[model samples]
Structure formats: C-alpha cells, structure tokens
Target: MTRARTLPAASHLEARLGLEMGQYSCAGRKAINEDAIGIRAPDGPLLTTKGVAAVIADGVSSAEAGREASQSCVTGFLSDYFSTPETWTVRHSVQQILTALNRWLYRSGQGLPDARRGFITTMSALVLKSQQAHLFHIGDSRIYLLRDGRLEQLTRDHTVPVGDGHRYLARALGLDIHLEADYRNLALERGDLFLLTTDGVHDVLGAAQLAELLVNAGDDLAATCRTLCDTALRAGSDDNLSCQLLRVSSLPTPEIDDVVGRLTQLRFPPPLAAGNVLDGFRIERELHASPRSQVYLVRDVQSGERFCMKTPSDNFSDDPAYIERFVLESWIGSRINSPYVARVVDPGRPRTCLYYLSEYVDGMTLAQWMREHPRPAVEEALYLVCQIARGLRALHRRETLHQDLKPDNILIDASGQVKIIDFGSCSVASIAEIATPLVRDSALGTASYAAPEYTVGRKPDPRADLFSLAVITYELLTGTAPFEGKLERCRSQRDFLATRYTPSYRINPRVPHWMDGALRKALRFHPERRHGDVSEFAHELQHPNPAYLEYHQRPLMDRKPLLAWQLIAAALAVAELVTLALLVG
Candidate 1:
C-alpha cells in the first residue's frame, strides 16, 4: 500500500492550504495488526470549504474483533464526516458522527456472548478547516504537534497510572455505554507537522527521539513513519504498531487582490439597451446603476423567463475591494435559500462576461414606497417591519449579516412580500475564518440607519440589524426619524449619547405611545440596551408593555427638559418683542 501522500497547493491565494500525509502500521510481535488509519483530501469545493481529514485507530488487544472494530471506526468516521451538511461547523459535524459511531460500537459489543471479548478501539482524528485544525480524541491514542523545531503532545492519554509504572485503559470505544471525546482547536502555521500514533509507538519512543526522527526524515513523511515504527519495535514494543504524519505546507492569505483579479479578468458587459441581447438573455431595461454596480431587467431568450442581471461597474474597475465585494454578493445570494431574501439564478449556459442573474422582484423599493405613504397606519407599518425582521433573522441564522440594511436595499414585491437585497457589504462568518486583510472600520450601512456602535469602531452584531430595523419602523410610523437623523452625524459614543430621540407621538399622534417605546428600545445607541433579538422587537411592536406606557406617560417637562426650556425661552422672547413693538408705535 502507498504509505505517503501530499496534497498540492489549492490556489495561488491559498498556497498554504495543502497537506502532506503518510502512515505505517505493523503487527511487530503481535499475531495481527489491529490498527487502522484513513486520510481524505478532497478537491474543488470540498477541499476549499472543508479542507482535509485524517483518522487513526488502535483496537483493544483483548477484544475478539479488535481489528474489525478499529478498521470500522477509522473508515466510518472519514466517510461520514464528509457526508454531513456543509452548513454545519466542523466541530458540530464531527461530534455528531462520533456519537453515532460510539452507539453502534457499544451495541455491537453488548451482543457478544463474552462480556470482555467485545469490539473496542481508541481513535484520534484531525480536521483541517481553513487555517485552523480541529482535533477529536478518545482513549489512549495520541496526537502530537511539531512546531518551531519543538514537539508537544496535543492529546491526553486516557489511562489511569497504577503501581510499578503500570497503567490501565480508562476510556475506549465500546468500553462504556456513553463516550466522552476530547476536542481542541489549534491555529495552523505554514510548515507545521503533526503526528498521530497508537500506544504501541508512543509508549516506546520518547518525545525527543520522535522529534529527532521526524526532523531527519524532513519532507519524506513515509520514511519518517517507517523509521518511527522500526525504532518502536527495536525498543521492545510487542503490540500492534501504527503511526501517521501530516505536514501543513501552505495556507490561504486573506488578501482580496487575487480573488478580485480572477473575478474581473473578464471584461464587464457593455451598457445594454432595451433591445440588446447578451449570453441568451435579452435586456428589457436598465433597473439601477451606481458607482459600484449596474442592475438590468432581462429575459431569457429561449425560456422567456424574466430575470435581473447585475454586473460590476466600470467606475470601480481598478478597485479590488469593490470588485471582490461584487463577486461575493452573488456567491452569498446563491447560498442563502430564503423567500424574504433575493434569489440568485444560475445562468444555464456559460457567460462570456462578468455578471450574475437574480430573480426579478417586480415591485418598488422600500424607499419609494415610504415616499408614497409618508405616515402609514400603525398596523401597516408593524406588518412591514415584521416581514423585514423575518428576513434579517434568516441571514443571522446562516451566520451572515446584511450589514447594509436600509430602505434602498429592501424590495417590496407586487404581492407585498419583502425581500432583502444588496449583499455587497454583507459579512459571512465562515468566509471571515479564511483570513482576510479587509478592515471592518468603515460602517457598511448608510449613516442614518447604521448602528451607533458601528460608528464607534465596535463590531456589529445582531442587535445592529435590529437598530436599523427600528429606524425604518420609526420612519414608517411617523414620517420622521427617531433622532431627526442625528445618528448619522455622531462621530463617537458621546455624540451618540447627546442625540435625543423625538417622540413618535409628537410627529404622528396616531402612533400609539407604547409602539414608540418599542422603537426607542430597539434604536438604543448602545447595542446592549436594544432588544435581545429581532423576534423580541417584533413582538413588542404588537404587544403593549406596561413599563413602556409608564415611561411614555411622563410629563413632557420631565421627559425632555431641554425641549421644555427651549419652549419657555421662546415664549419670553415673544413677549419682550411684542412690548418693544407697542412702545415704539
């Protein structure tokens, strides 16, 4: 069998996202080699998204089906881990699989006629996702790391020390009805090496000896593995011998220039006229255009289906950041499957230029709708707010943030369904893990709707979206902003605190006082002061809370002393002006 394999670099941008692996197993003096190892290095999307996985298992020598148990655990974990949902985090997917595998092993052991002769094994697995390594371990098997010319054990040996330097296995698959596996995450650096070994190898070779052998072997991991096992056997290791080696050759950098260069290599499609056709799609009309991108209404020539096509703007042709964002927008839209969010369409045929298609929302933007209905009824405004909140919740659940949430980015279809659009400024948690140089200092959303925390250089959270929603809700109900657009001018926390909210009832008396309180809480300058979640904010809009009512009922003089004093000063000035005019006459 091939004992060594090396995964070449994935991409120029991710040169470090590759691994070299090797394994060697020997029975030594034992009758059979009850040890197994598996490695999976997939290509394309799986390689880019999930990276690589390696597993090593050592079966209990006392068990009758030890070899079968070890082989099954190793093979089962590698196959099942990749089959898990791509949306699941690495820890979640691996843990779920390990739990099921343990249950199966325990049940199989129970069916054995001899209680002591059951299927049992110790396993350790590693998953290299992005720039981090996730490790899962059980029983006495070990995983070690060699970095900066030093070797350190990464897994704890699950054994109880006894007299005369003897130890007993305390944890192993099928040893108990329940299993508790150890998990850890380590940041990966280029040229780092990792070693996985069963007790037969680790117990015989000390850390110094192992590190020396690995360093001497250099890039030949297969030779290193063979040498380690041979040394273990020479040191009187009489059990099944197994060892695996892995090296991180490269990792992906967070720079956007490479991604942008590849995406923009193709020229942007020329400005299309109503009768123009490109790539099987006929342009009906231009929908929108900005410095960042252009959107046009189009129809498939063959199927006659209407769609919206978006292409990067020539104005930003040299701006790598803008180009990267434009491409990511389409990528995000395609992955997210939500009715409340705009849908990205896959153009059946290949395209000659750089552009993407999306479902056409045959309705006006929320900004236009707000212009027509300056002061919508409370119920109508709440309905729209709830729909928008539901859309935001969908993005949040997928570990994505629609950072630029504003009236212009919201589309209200003809059927009155709200769909959030424009993912140019959106942030995806998974993508962020890939290491990028992009700075988060600039606020992604419009100043008027952006959360105060964003202006102060704080990371935007779910509450930030809630804050933007509240601004929209307040405007819908009162034809005016809660803070008279002061939030946009706030440069710091102090400026945000000094900005006072204008009462919704003062602008539109029809707006219930309790509803104003809900909006105020959601739009709080401090994220912590806002609603815990979007659902809570939506609930509060429809339900009247006694606390909000009491607060809203406070006398104007006490509630807003600055406004009260301004009114009093104005009245005195008017009286003085009248007296002076009368005396002069």
Candidate 2:
C-alpha cells in the first residue's frame, strides 16, 4: 500500500511543513504605515490539506481610503477562499474571491463610513499547495522567483505608460466593479527561495543585490526577510517597507488517492504553432498574447473550418479567477446572436480552458474605416448606419446594453454590414443594482463619446446607447466629431457641443438636405430628443423628411428689439395691402 504525506503527525512536523508567516511594517518616510498584511486559519483543519499562507497589501498614500480598503481586500479574499470547498481549483478560488472583493469594495466606497474610499493600492500574495507556489496580485507589489541563482518578477504591475516612468497603476485592486488579479504557478525546488515585497524594497534594490542577500542570508527564512526590509531602509527608501520570504525543502505533493475529480476537464498545452489542431480545429494564426492568456485563429481540422481560441496567460495556469471570467465571456458570447455582435460558438466552463470560438470576420473597425475612407457617400454611410441601428434593436430586445459602444467596438464588413464586438463591460439590468449610486458616476464607458450624464451619478439607459450612435453618425456625415479638439486643449464641454453640423449639402452639395436634417435629429445631445429606438432611427433614414420633433430643446431664443422690429414691419405690410384693396373697391 502506498502511504500519504499527512499533515505533520508529530507536533513538531505540523509546525514544520505548516509554518505561520507574518509581517513588520515601517513608516520609513511616509506619514503613515498604510501598508498591511493578514492571515487566518479559523480551524486547524482548514490548513490540513494545504497549509494556509500569507497575503500583503501596500496602499497608495496619495489616495484617502487606501489603508482600510487594502487590508479588507486581503482579509476578505483569504476568508472566502478558505471556507470554500477544497475540490475547487485555484483559478475558481481566486475568481470568486475577486468578484466578492470587488462587490464589497465598490459598495463600501459608495456609502458613508467608507474608511478606505478612493484609496488605491498595490497587492501581492502567496498561497502554498503541497510543493507548488501560487501567487496572486495586481498593481505593483511583486512576486520574485529565485531559481538557479536568478531572480524573476512573477507579477506584472498595472501602472500607466511612462518611458517606463508612469506612476499610477493602470489597473488596481478595487478601482471598478470588475476586478482581476494576475497569478503564477511554479514548482518549489529545494534551495529555491520566494520573496514577496512592496515597491519600497524593489524600487531601491537592483536584481543583483536581491540575489546576493538570498544567497548569504543562510537558513533563517525570517532573518532573510528582515535583511531585505533593513536593506531597503538603509538605502534611504522613502515609502512603507514590507517583505515575506519562504524557503522550502522536500515540499509536499498531492497523492492520487487524495485528489477529487471535477466534472470539467481542462488541460493546458504550451503555446501552439500554426497548423496545430485542438478540439478538432486547426490553428491558423496567432491573435493576441498578454501575460494572462493567448488567442489564436483555429479552424475545424475535419471541415477545414476556422475560429478563435483563447488560453490562459503563461503565468496564470493556477489562477481560478481568470478561468472563471474567460468561461463567463465564452458563454455570454455563444448565447448572444446578433450580426452586430461577435457570435460565439463555444462557451467554456470550469472543466475546459477558456477560448472564444467565434465566426471568422473580415472587415475594418469603424475607426479604421473612417480614417481610410474619410468621406464615404451619404447614401452609403446611412445604409451602413441603419444596419447598426437594426442590430442594436435586437440587442435591446434581449435586454442587453453594450456598455462599451465606442468606434473601435464597431466593425464594418465587406458588405458594409456593421458588427458590434467586445461585450467585456456588459452588465445584466436589474432594478436594485442599477440604482447603486457609485456605479452611476464612475465613467464606465469610453470618454469623448460618453454622455454627460455619465460624468454625473446617473444610471445608464437605452438613451446612453443613442448618445453614442449619434456621435458616430455625426462623424460619419461630417469629417469631424462634435468634440474634435485635443482633450487637453478642449477647456469646456460647451466648446465641443454639436450646435451646428456642416450641412452635408454645404460640404458635399450633391448630398440631399432631407438626409442632413434626419441625421441631425439622431445626434441629439439629450437622450429624450434622440430617436427612442434604433428601428425608428433607421426608418427616419429612409424618409429623411419625416416630421420629427427636434432632438434637443433649442436654446431659448434671445429675442431682442431689432428682431421684434423686423417682425412688426412684416405684419404692417400685410395689413397695408388689405386696406389698399378695400379703398380700391
């Protein structure tokens, strides 16, 4: 009979493989030790299968609510993941944790008593399973892998672009309703060391210095962690400093008998090459490759058919959260059928690697189409736009809102058929959820095309969709958009308001006047004034002279004395003509 590696049968062994890790925070030069870390094992059994590990968070000092939010996020994720079933995979575990955390953070930031409101933070965590190391993170706090005497950063920072010099994070732990974390899985080799730390340590030390310390720090794992913190402090670091280190030997591995089988079966193969066949499909072209996943053009090997395949980013095989989202998008794409929407033929679940098997499309994005063909014929443009309206009508009937309805999200096919894509930002409509105050003002959609109501706390509606379409229509007819100047140079909204269009007849006099008026009505600034439904808007395109109410309330006319005199003169002339006729009789 084979023997299992049970949790230390002896008290010392239990204390050995299952070590309790912790932290020491130093203010360094900051006003507050806003940095934090948390750990919990409510029951010894909770750590029985795979011992629990530590999580650390470093809040940005600039934001007011960073401290509490970061701390809460770490504690909340650990609490939720641990209580869940052991049968759950790492990716699923992290997905639920992030979703729950985002829901809590978004809610916490909205109402009063928001201790960590508006605060952004960088986070890094380590979860040990048998001998494998699982790292979960977002923002800049990093995970470094030490193997064969080399150090590698496991988590990529989500900061904005700089000459490698931008400061703020591009993506954060709790910035939006949807939050995602990057994760990595690595085998624990004996003498292999793992270091997790805030920027305080990395911002000051070079890779060479980090390797030197791990080599000389000897057998004391805690002391090695302390040395890193001390080194950064000595280097005159000016931010909160924190670090956690783990050195492993003969790491535990799951026994075959101990593992539970899942209904879903998912296996990952290394990056694929052109001509490789998967699930009966042959790979054609590679599309996108980010740290989390890769996308490829795949065709049915048997039928010589093609579609898209998306797999986890190289470092995220152990990430349960990413897999969940990948699966969700896959499912959503398959069920939604609209010529304007990207059609999905496959939706992934827990058992399968996430992929999008979509109908292969050949066309230019609206942005590209407009740029290349600056001025398409009016009739042709309207025909193309009407197609978009009809598709949107179908989408509305399904009760779906394309939260991200920007130019890039629209594609124009060879037939001039418009296809809408990228439903990543979509949300189901619900009375209570829509009423939430914070989501109303956070600017969920793209700027420039976004409605003014989005800048304020207003729930999105179908009219929001109209506002975007109007922006597109205005640009298609006119060479420029309503807001044409550089964002930095445009001082106020008033400067960009669509008051007067360059009448298509004026620009291209051959264009009919009726078409211009109808287009103007569709591009109304206020939603109420715009066509109520896409079908109505499309119909108006055919009958450009249809009697329609103005899209927006005309600015109250400023009637002055000069204008009143002209009107009075005209009325007097009409009366004079009537008197002359009576005198002649």
Candidate 3:
C-alpha cells in the first residue's frame, strides 16, 4: 500500500505539506538485483523542514560490485539528508552528501583492477520542499513529472550512444574524481505525480505507459509502482527493474506568507515616550529613529531589566514586503547566540504589536567609538574586529549573511566587549528556499561597507560579509576609507576595479607594512580575491600572510601608483639639476 504522510502545522490556518510515496524493485530475469530504491519523510517539523525525499539507483552491470554500489548510495543519501543542518537549502544539503558519498566510493575502490568495476551507479533523487520539488541526478536513472495528466521528463540521461540500440553512461558517481550532479527545481502543485525509474523499467515501458499507470494508480501508489515493475518485466526486460513514485497531495503555505496575512490585524505601536508601558515593556527613552524604523530602550516591567526594542515605522505598516523583512530580522537574531552578538531576549509575554527586544549594551556604537579614538592602534583595532568576526561566524554557520556590517551596526561596550548588531539586511539561505510572492529586498548594505558584488547585481556569499568587516577594520586603523570613500560612487564592476586603494600605512603611522597587506587583500573589490570567510580574515589580521606580503612587494607602481609617480618626478628633478650644473661648468 502507498504511505501518505502529512506534516502537521502548528497554526491551524497554515496548509500542511503532504506526500504519498511508493516503491518496488525486482531482479526480473537477472540472477542478481542491482537496482536500489528509497523514500523517506520524517514526521513533525522535519517533514516540512527537510521535506520528503526519494532516490533511485541503478548500478552498472559491468561493475563487479554493482549491487553494493546501488545499495550503499540509496541508503547513505536518505540517512545523510536529514542529518544536515536545517538552515541549509535542499540543493546545498544534497550536494554535500552526494560529494561525500562520491568521495567514499572512489576511495573504497582503490587498488581494485578497475575502480568503476567496484563502484559505479546511475542515481536520481528528488526532494519536495515547501512549494517546490528539487531534483538531483547523475547517469541514466530518470525522474518524470506527471502534472494535470501530461507527462514530462525532468532529467536528461548522462549517456552517449554509439551504433545499434546501445547507450553507455558517460557520467556517474565514482567514475571521476570530481562529481557534478545536475540540479534543478520546479514549483509544485497539489495532485502532481512524480515518477522515479531505473533503465530496466523505463527502457521497457515508455512515458506513455508510465503516465497511464499513474493516471489509473489512484491513491494506491504502492500497487501502482509494483505494477510498473511487473509490466516492465513482462515486456522482456532482462535486467533488474525498480520504480518509485511520489504524489504531492498538499503544498506548504509558507509561514511568512501566512504571517503576512495576519500582520494586517496587528497594530504598529504609536510613537513611544519615556515611562510609557506597552506589552509589559516600559519605554525608557528613544535610542534612535529613522523613516523606516525606531529603536528605544525599554524596561521589562516584570524583570526590571533594560533592553533595546526595535519597532517598525508607521510608513511601512501597510507594506507586506516591509513587514516580511521586519519579521525576518527578529527571526534571524533570535536564532544566533554568541557573546559577541547582541542576544535577542524573548519577552515570554503575548504581543499585540510589531516589535522585538535585544539585550541592552551600555556602550556607544563603533562609529562613535572610532570618532573618540581617532586612529586606533592596529593591535586594538584587530582585537575588536576579531570579536566581531566571531559574531559573523555564528550567523554564517546558520547560513545567514550579515549584509550590513558598518561601524554604526557594531557596538563596543564599556567592558571592551564588541557586539555585532542589526540584521535588517541579512540574507538567509534556507529561508530563500521557500517560495514567496513578495519581493525581497536586495542584501545591500552601507555602500562603503557593502561588497562590490551587490553594486554589480551579483549574488553574495560569506565573502560579502568579510568585505564589509574588512571595511570596518580598515577605517578603524586608518581613520579613512580604503578607496577614499569612493565605493558608494561605483555603479558597475569596472568603476569599482578602477578605484585605487589608499594604503593604511600612508594614512596612519602606527600601521605596519605587513598588516596593511592583510587589509588590502580583504578589501579587494572582487569577492573572490578576498579571504574565504570571517575566520580566515580574522586569522590573517593578527598573523602575517606571506602571500600578500610578497604580492605587495612588487614594483611601487603596482602597489601604490601615487607614491611611485612622486618618486619618478623627484628623480627627474634631480637629473635636471645635475645637467644644469654640468652645462655651467
């Protein structure tokens, strides 16, 4: 019988994600079955978090351990998919598992007469997440989507055909050192049927037959899959046969979208004043206010502790996109925990308005701190940034990018502990996986601190945060922007690359030449040229990276053109003086 699974939603108004899965395998006329199939959908939140997964693998018959290859891959993928962090997108999670599986298979086959003889299999896997279906495949196993009674093949067979009716797989896991799985995703609709099949079953039964079986399958997907395999066997398939099927009975209504609908009911608190109480929090004073949002220091009436409360501006109270972004800020902040990050505190009380609270830090913003300490020593600046990097790592670990890393967004307490603040412009990868009708704001930050990738309309990664962090560190030590504060004026890639970097040593006498090299590399206009991540950038800040030191050791013109030109001009003046003296003699 087919197993139908439905994820239970916490909110009664939210639609659940549901799936019906079925699988069947048969050796048919073959002496050994080399095909493997699997379907997994955990109950509770996991059903919505990781979604339902199904994989089909057909081991290469020419391989000596074809059965082992097929079986290992099918089981390994199912187990590892759920093991990955919930913050990872389905594609990223599946890709990591596939890479690890491929590496293990390749290494285990070592010393054998032929590596492919020991491990080689064609595989196809599908994940139904949120309102979409993501596909990952290699070799000839096929995944087909039957929607509204029309059948369409979603994957291409990684094979090359020679003469006759024979096609050999050109791409399969364990066949090469590097594995490249083809990936794509599609919007899912209710009542959609997806089919997974190995060559044994698909070769004998064409798309027409598969569509016919699915149409008549009804709700008994198990019987439908078994019939598929049996029909293929009767059609004279001489190899092992396998078939797996999944029907999307329900697609998840994203929590954000559901909340957006509810947002219309919640009221934005009126402008707050000192001693005013709202939702158990007494306003102490307004910390900051802008056209979009306002920040206020509040006292928890029960706990009597102070916190920073952020409330959306009335200007955007009616804007769904703005409301969504505002909600995500609290969601992102509440999840990350680190000493270097401002901790979000749950009020433990029901709310009737739009706002969030974070622990209050008794200190000034890094921007103000920079103004007071003008031209901070390299050591002190690096120490502060290292702490800032720790907070960044916390967000990065959860697949979140703190797009805005300006000095104004960082705070240094009286105790000298640095805390990174602000998550308004962050980009969360896992959340990005969810389909939304509202447009998301670009992950652009303060132009001087934001990476050039955003200005060029390119996607950013952790390196974008590294770039912003580097800008903050550079200004702390040099008391000036690296590119003379021209990054904001750069509208395109060419403009950004053409801008020159002002050396930290030139702006501040305390900065050492080697330390300046680290800053310069981190401040590269191109994200790829910057450090790999926050940790690497933090490490290079304290330790000397010889590669960058040697890179800066090249001719003066390459490192600093202004200084190079000044020396050339001075040398020319001396030569002219010497010529005049000789002529007079």
Candidate 4:
C-alpha cells in the first residue's frame, strides 16, 4: 500500500544517477554450475522508460539442461523488458515479459527425457525505476535491501522442507505450465543498497555474516561481492557461489539548468515565409502563429508528403523551462498511438532546428465545427464525446494527463472523425518524476474549461479531464458554459462548493433527464464525487443509470427556481389581501 513517493524538483534532486553493480558466479566444488546473472543499465531514453534491470537465476543441479535454462531466462528477460512499449507501466511490462519467458521455458523443455526436472531454475529479477524498486521472484532465489545500515530480505524463498532437513523448490520457472511469480514495488532512496543471491551463497553465509561483509565491504561493490563470495566458499559453500550487488547513488532530477544546458546547443531556426525551405522541409504556409509558437504546413521534399511543423517562437529563446516543455511535447506525442489522437511523424531526416512534425489533420478545429453546426442531436454530441473519451483514455493509460482539454484543442476531420490533438500543456508521468525548478501548475488549460481542482491548486488527473469534457458536453447541449463560467474562476474549495450548479436541461428541453443527470455527475466540483473514470461516465451517458435517479428528487427550488419563487410571491399576495379584507370589515 505504501507506493513510491515522487520528490519535488530541487537542486538536491539534480544529483547524478549512478547505480554501482557487482556480480560473481562460480561452480565452487561442482564441476558444472547452473547459475547465471544479467544486468542492463541503459543511458538513453530507454533508461527513463525501462529503468535498470538486474536478474539472477539458479538452475536445479539435478536437471540435465539446468545450465541452459538459467542462461535462457536471464538473457530473455533482459532483452525483452527493454524492448517492450515505453507506454507500458513497470508492473504490466515486466509481468508480460516474464510470463512469456515462463511459457517459452515450459514448452521448449518438453522434448527432454524427464519433462518434470527439465529446464528448471529459480529466478529473481529487480528493476530500479524512477524512485522505486520493482521485484519479481520465483523459487529459492533471494533479494535483500540494505537501507540505513539495516539489511532486510525482500523476497520469500519458494521452497518446501522435506524430512531430515531437506528442502525442494515448490515454485520455479518451467516447473509447471502455469507461472506464479511474486511481484512487489518499494520506494527507493538514495544510497540504498540491494543484494541478490542464490541458495548456494545464502545457505552457507548467514544473514548476520552477510550483513557484516556488506558493511565492511563499504563503497566498493565489486570488492563487497568478491569478499562475500570468498567468505561463502570458505564457509564450505561447496554447491555453488553466486551473488549480485547494486547501490543507488542518486536519483534523476529535473533541474532547470540541466534543460538550459541541453537546449542552448540547438539554436532556433530563422524566420521563414512560403516557398522557403529548411532541412528538406519546404514551408508551404504558416498554419497558426501565436505568441508562444508558429505552426507551419510543410512539405517533405524527399517523400513529397505533407505534415505540420511546429516551432517555438524566438520570443522565449532564452527561456529554459519553455524549451524543455516544448521538447517534452514531442516526446509525449511520439509515445502515444491512437486514431482518436493526433500522431507525431518522424521526418526521416535530421532536423537543423528546434521543431517537431505532426500528421496533417485535414479538418477544422472542434470550435469551428461547433460554429458550423450550432445545435447537434443528443446522439451526435455523445458520439463525439465518446471519441474524445477514447482519446483521453489512450493518454491516461500511458500515465500522461492532457492537463489542457478544450474544444480548440480537438480536431474534426472532413470525414466527421474526431481527433484530440496537442501536447503543449500535457504532463508525462516519467518526465514529472524528475524534479523541476520551475513552478508547475496543476492545470494549464483555458480557465473557461479547466476543472475546479485546477483553480484550487490540486493536481490534475484523468477525472479532471473528464470535468473538461463534461463542460464541453454541457456547452454543446445548452449553448452556454456551466455555472456562467464560475467553475474556473473558483479560487478555493469553498468557492466551488458555494457555486450553484445549473443543470443543462433547464436551458435545453431537448436533453433527456437521465442524460442531464450524467452531465451533472461528471461536472461535480469535487473529483471524488465525479465518475471514477472515463468509461463510467461514458456508460452512464449512453444508458440510464438508476443510481442517478436521485437527481430528479431534488427540492422544487433546485428543480425549478422560477416556479418555486413565483409560488412564494403568490402566497404573500394572498395573505396581504386577506389582511386588507379584515381591515375593511
């Protein structure tokens, strides 16, 4: 339940990341040892996505091809984990890879004389991602954490004891057709040390002695591993000796200077007009130009393909945070794939300036579409909303938030297909993990459509986007912003709570009562009261939810303010007339 915590951007977080690693494996007294180890620490973007992977496998000595099994698992996991889609979460990606490796190990070893012991090995894997350590274990392999000078074992050995102090592996890779691996994630801290060992080393060296060795070994991880292994061998570890060591030196941070140092190397491109060419991209015409950026419709001279090239304005050429965000917009776009969302195009050639290319959407902005068709049917509007929800889902699943969701950011193609575009104000979870020096707003969308949580300085989530979508839907139905646009103007939780909610049905009689209930729920000022996710909101919109039947049971004042007030006025008039009659009598 205690997940990893994200540290805010600061100078301390800017410390360089270096994970010291040391591993050693030997057969000891045995002529053939079936122990294998692998470690991969990538330096590029893969480092941010896949993190660092460390694995150890101990093959069953009784199995004929135990050595092959251990080697295959170690190699397969390391290669496949990094190759997975970067959009995947650490848990989902690692589980899928390990499961596939498990199936392959199970099927491939079926040709052996005894399939039971064939290709049997214990595997323990550790992934050091942003501010966390993810672990997967099976069989007797062990993982230990050394923090604050206290060494604690993090993995449970999957073994069952037999008679006369004998034990056998109850769970191991390729031991059964079904794989049941233990997985857990823990918060990471600087200077935290991790140890992995096979039964050969652990059985010989007690935890106390091993902790002492690790302590005396100190900063020299290689020396620590060697000393531990030698000590284990000396202690009569005759079967085999294998162990791995890793220490977290630092955590990656989002220092402002870091971004400036990198952005200064890439100078901004010069002013351009139609027919001007730069880096094999011919500028056909400028599509949109703002104080922030200039979007140009460009033609790739080599492929003759057309696309949109977005370049940051030179006005902020000296700005580092803006430059970093511009670069990240392109990075976020490249990771997402959905027909409902815009696609980032790779130019195939190196660019000479700071710019990005996106697929040319042959359509108008949702705002323009709304103007052309002022009043759409309920079904039509909901259809458009469902498409946008799907697009939002794509972003949400990737751990990204479209902090800015509004009509202007959406595109409606000539074919009537909808696509949510733009990553300018989006937030990527991986990038956010790095500490930033600049102030990061919880929401960056237009105030008119931004959620109340943003106004209150609360962090935005997918539900915040849902609030924006509900605002758009309400506008489509009532031809007006909800609460006269007071929602975004809200500056405090109490302000939002005090703002009177105006149901859409009051303005548009065509809206079904049930549908309006759905809108009201999604438009709740507090995120907790809103639908848990996009799918829930979409489902309630398409179908009548009996749960929302309470919506229609409100007091007459809320149901019809004018009618209720009119009745009160009528009663007051009648009471005054009755007093006048008594006075006349």
Clashes per candidate, residues 3 or more apart or on different chains: 6, 20, 0, 3
RMSD in Å for candidate 1, one decimal? 6.5
Task: Report lDDT (Cα) of residue 297, candidate 3.
Answer: 96
In candidate 1, position 83 carries an lDDT of 78
Q: Per-residue lDDT for 193-227 in model 1, tens only?
A: 99999999999999999988877766678777888
Question: Per-residue lDDT tens digits of candidate 4, residues 1-585?
Answer: 011223222222243456778888888889988999888877666776667899999998888788999999999989999987776677777888878887888887798888886888999999987677899999999999988879999999898899899998899998888999999988888878899999888999988988887776566676677777788888888877788898877776445666467666678989989999989999999989999999999998988999999999999998776777788788889989999999998888888899999999989998988887788887888989999999999999887889788999999998878888889999766555544566544456888888887788777778999999999999887778888878766778888888877777888888988888899999888799999988889888999987556657788898779999999999999999999999999
- Which regions of candidate 3 are displaced past 4 Å? 3-21, 25-36, 40-51, 58-80, 101-122, 147-152, 156-180, 186-192, 211-219, 237-240, 248-259, 270-287, 296-307, 489-498, 551-574, 577-585
Question: RMSD, model 3, all Cα superposed?
Answer: 4.6
RMSD of each: 6.5, 18.6, 4.6, 6.3
Instruction: List runs of model 2 lying over 4 Å from the truth.
Output: 1-277, 288-295, 310-326, 347-351, 430-444, 485-514, 545-585
The lDDT per prediction is 0.83, 0.63, 0.86, 0.83
lDDT per residue as tens, model 3, 215-319: 888788888988998999889899898888899887776566575675566688898899999999999999999898999999989889999999999998778
RMSD of candidate 2 to the truth, in angstroms, is: 18.6
Q: Which candidate would rank higher by TM-score, 2 or 3?
A: 3
Q: Which wins on TM-score, candidate 3 or candidate 4?
A: 3
> Judged by lDDT against the true structure, how good is candidate 1?
0.83
The deviation in Å at residue 157 for candidate 3 is 5.1
lDDT of 1 at 453: 75
Candidate 4 residue runs with Cα over 4 Å from true position: 1-16, 26-36, 57-76, 87-123, 129-140, 145-193, 215-230, 233-241, 248-258, 435-442, 549-585
lDDT (Cα, 0-100) at 496 in candidate 4 = 82
Q: Against the true structure, candidate 3 has what lDDT?
A: 0.86
